[model samples]
Every structure is written in C-alpha cells, then in structure tokens.
Target: MAPLALLVAAFLAYSVPPYLTFDPALSRVPAPPGFAAHYGFLVAHILFGTIAIVGVILQIWPWLRRTHPVVHRRVGRVYVFAGAIPSALMALVIAPFSSFGPAAAGLNVVAALLWLGSTIAGWRAIRQRRYADHRKWMVRSFAMAMNTLLSRVYAPLAFLGLGPSYPKLGELIPAASTLAGTMSMLTLLLLSQWWLDRKPKKPAIAR
Candidate 1:
C-alpha cells in the first residue's frame, strides 16, 4: 500500500508539469539575463527528478533495501548527488530572478540548501553505520524531494484563495510551498526517530 501510494504520487509529480504552462505573472518578473533562454536547465530538472523518484522506490522496497545493500547505496549516491546538486543549481539560478519576487526566491534558496544538507548528512550517517541518524537524515532528504508534491498542493490553494488578479498572492505560493514541504518532512523524520528509539535493542550473549 505504501509503495503503491508513493508510485502514484511520483507519477502525478512527473506528469503534471508538462501539462501546465508557465504562469503569466512569472513572465514579467526580472530574472538573471538568459536564465530562461537555455533548455539545459529543464533537461537537468527532468533527469534529476526521474532519478529521485527511482531512488524513492528503492528506498521504500524492503527486498531491495535489505538484499542488495550495495546497489541501494549506489542508487542512493546517484539520488543525492544528482538530485540535490542539480536542484541547488537550479534554485540558485532561479531564486534571484524569480518572477514571484524575493519571498519565493528566499524560500527556494532555503529549500535547496536544506535538501543538499540533509542528503549529505544522511549519506555520512550511513557511512558511519549510524542507522538511527541515517533514518532521520533520509527522512529530511525525502522531504526535500517531496517538495514537488507540496508545490502542486500549494499552487492551487494559493490561486483559489488569492484569485487570479491578486498581485502579491503569487509570491506567497513558493514561500508557502517550501515551508509546508519542510515542515511535513521534519514531522515525518521526528516520528520515525521516535519509533526507532523506542524499539528494543538485541542483547549480545557473553562468550
């Protein structure tokens, strides 16, 4: 059921963007010169988003997580390396130049940095065999990755609440999206950590 839900979410995320055109409000906004002129950014985003989805699948599957630890590790490395790096770069490029203004830009920067930091920390925790820490960090990474989901949810809400003509309303969308995504991710991470902490540790027999 969990895997099925994740898969559905992933498909919705990957498919939704192609159908939506850029917001008109976004067009009038000042961005760094030539930011939208290149197709490479779009390509990179698709590539990384695809890989991140695949990584999530592997992370959630018990058989893959347990039986092929090396493959899992490799995939995870690809996920963090590709997902966070490209996202950060994209954010850096877009944030300042955002049509939505500084609120959106600032949130983008924060989200990108948090995503990068969580993935790095998760990778480090796993390397040190700190399973508890790894779990927490991975939750953070997953939350960051799930920002796509949050963005989708918030955009509609913003549009509905602010209506079409509201000038500043669009600016709130990105900020709200980022905040919601981060908070959701942190909540899940903390719950998982609590659960892990409560589990009984196995006893080692004396020689």
Candidate 2:
C-alpha cells in the first residue's frame, strides 16, 4: 500500500496539469501578480518536487535502504541536492498564486518556508551522521509534500458531503479547499511525528 500510494503521489506530482500555468478553472483567480511568475515557479516546483518525492519514497523502503545502501546514498544526493532544495525554493515563489485565497496563500508561504528548512535540516542531519534525526526530518518533509494530494482529496469529499456540485456553494470553494488543506497538513504533521516517537531511541544521533 505504501509503495502504491507513493507511486500514485509521484504520478500526480509529475502528471498533474500545471495549475498556475494557465488561467483555467483551478487557477482562475489572480492574486495581485499574474501568471508569468506563477507558471515559471510552478513548473520548477512540480518537476523537481515530484522527483524528490519519488526519491524519498524509495529511500523510505526498508528493503532498498537495507539491501542497497549504495543506491540509497545516490538517490539521497539527488533528493536533497537536486530535487528537494530547488522544489522548496520554487514553492516559495509560486505560493502566492494559491487560488484558494489569501489565507491559503499565506499558509502556503509558511509551509514552503518550513519545507525548505526541513529538507535542509534533513540533509544536514545525514551529513552529521545523525541517521535518526535525518529520517525524522525526511518523514516531515515527505508529509508536507503531500499537501497538494490531500487538499485535492479533501475538496471533492467536502463538495460531496455538503450537497453535490458547485451549485451548492460555488463561491466558497476556496474556503472549503483551504480548510481541508490546512487540516491535512496538520494531521500529517502530527501523525508523522507520532510515528517517529514510537520508534526505539538509538542514541539520538548516530555519531
């Protein structure tokens, strides 16, 4: 299930139409600035972000990590150096285009800030040989990366649960989507951190 979910996530990240690339339904609202910056940053964000996601997902697999340490290290380099860093940085730029609303856009700014910090921290942890801390931060980073996926999931469910289509509450889609996305981010944070806590302590830092 984990692998399948990871695959789907990677697929979405790669194949999902560039929401900000055009003034379509998903990205209809123009928040101050227009589409050029939005499109550029979004392109950078999704491409590298998806690569990082796929790398991290494979890194999390115990079998691959255990049996093929070499592969893990190589992908880790790509994840941190090539994918995560650039993706998070680009997210910072495009976050303002969150069609949901200003609140959503603002929260996205916060998330991008945190995501960049965590990915960098995770990279530093590995360098310092604190494998445990590295893993913990990577989990956090991955969870935040699921922001897009979860929000999409929640919005449709919210629409259905409320009534049916846009006719029920069309204008409020932003609010509903924002609410759902925020909940998803928080839930993922708590659950991932809790999972870390359940693991047996191993000298805090590896050394």
Candidate 3:
C-alpha cells in the first residue's frame, strides 16, 4: 500500500512535468549555463530514476514475485541495468550543482554510491543463491533510490513552515534548504535500514 502510494506520487511529481517545465526551486536544480552535458545528465537521471523507482516498487511486491517469477526478474533487470546504474552514475555528475548547497551535494554523492553498491550487491547475492542477502541489499538500494521523494520534501516543508518568518530569514533560505534536504536524506537512509533489519517473529510452534 505504501509503496504504491509513494511510487505513484513520485511519478506524478518528479517524473515528468517538473523536468519539462524546469522550475529551479521545484526541480531542486539551479539553471545550468547553457551547457549541453548538464542537460543530458539531468534528463537521463530523471528518466531513468523514474524507471528505477517503478521497477523497485514492483520488484518489492511479494505477490508479483510469487506469481510472476519471470516478470519479477525482468523488472529487476530493468531496475538495475537500465535504470539504477545509469541514474546513479549520472547523479554523481550533476550532484555538485545542487541548488541546496555543498552539504546536499555531498549527501547526494553518498546516496548515489549506496544506491549503486547495494543494488549490485543484491544482484550478486541472488546469483549466489543468497536470497536473504539479496532482499536485504535490495531493500537498502530502494531506500537510497527514494532520495527522489525524500529530498524533494524538505524544501517545501521548511519554506512553508517558516513562511511567517520568511521576510527576515530570506537570505538564509539556501542554507536552510541544504540543511533540511540533507537531514531528510540521512533520516530516510537510517530509517530504511532499520526497518529492513527488524527481525520477523518466529511462528509459534504447534499452536
């Protein structure tokens, strides 16, 4: 239920119109100085990131994995080979230009690294028949991929929550954006790992 809601919202928000309209604040990227490479990476990142998010969402659904094994593998391939890897690589290229600041940029770099690492590790674990490890690593990877949803949240929350004080604090808005955005990313990363690591209770024997 949660994944469905989140994936849908992500596609609606960050996936398309925002990129086409290209609002600096809403898109969370400052305008590049007419550079082609920047535009290339930005578009690639958004397009593939959307694919990764949707792929991860479907891949995590237990029913799909159980009922459609072939589809699950296909989606998993799309998530990794065609989506996450390229998106993460392009993310590393464009992260430094984050309008939020250096802190936000650094957090993005970390997110990209973990996103790629955990995804690849998950793939290798599956190949080695370590299903548990595969699930664990994929959970972590999806959480990193969720930076798309989490990072977009902080700016609005801070700006709107601080609206009454906006006049006086206008100059500090950029710093506030960075602080809120970076903290959001870290909080999501930690929470996701914790959620994934919680042990399921053993079924009562002979009940």
Measured by TM-score, the strongest candidate is 3
Q: Kindly list the per-residue Cα lDDT of model 1 for residues 179-201, writing each as its tens digit.
A: 45445555555655576568576
| lDDT minimum window of 10 residues, candidate 2 | 20-29
Question: What is the C-alpha lDDT profile of model 3 across 49-124, one tens digit per residue?
Answer: 8788878888988889999999999999999998899999999988877665577678778889889999999999
- Write the number of the candidate with greater lDDT, choosing between 1 and 2: 2
TM-score order of candidates, top first? 3, 2, 1
Report each candidate's C-alpha RMSD, comma-separated, in the order given: 5.8, 5.2, 3.2
Off by over 4 Å in 2: 1-3, 6-14, 17-35, 161-170, 199-207
Clashing pairs in model 3, backbone N/Cα/C closer than 3 A: none
- Over 108-176, each residue of candidate 2 has an lDDT whose tens digit, in order, gives 887788778888899899999998899889888877777666766677666565454346464567667
TM-scores for the candidates: 0.67, 0.80, 0.82
lDDT for model 3, please: 0.79
Sort order, lDDT high to low: 3, 2, 1
Q: Candidate 3, after superposition: displacement of residue 162 in Å?
A: 5.8
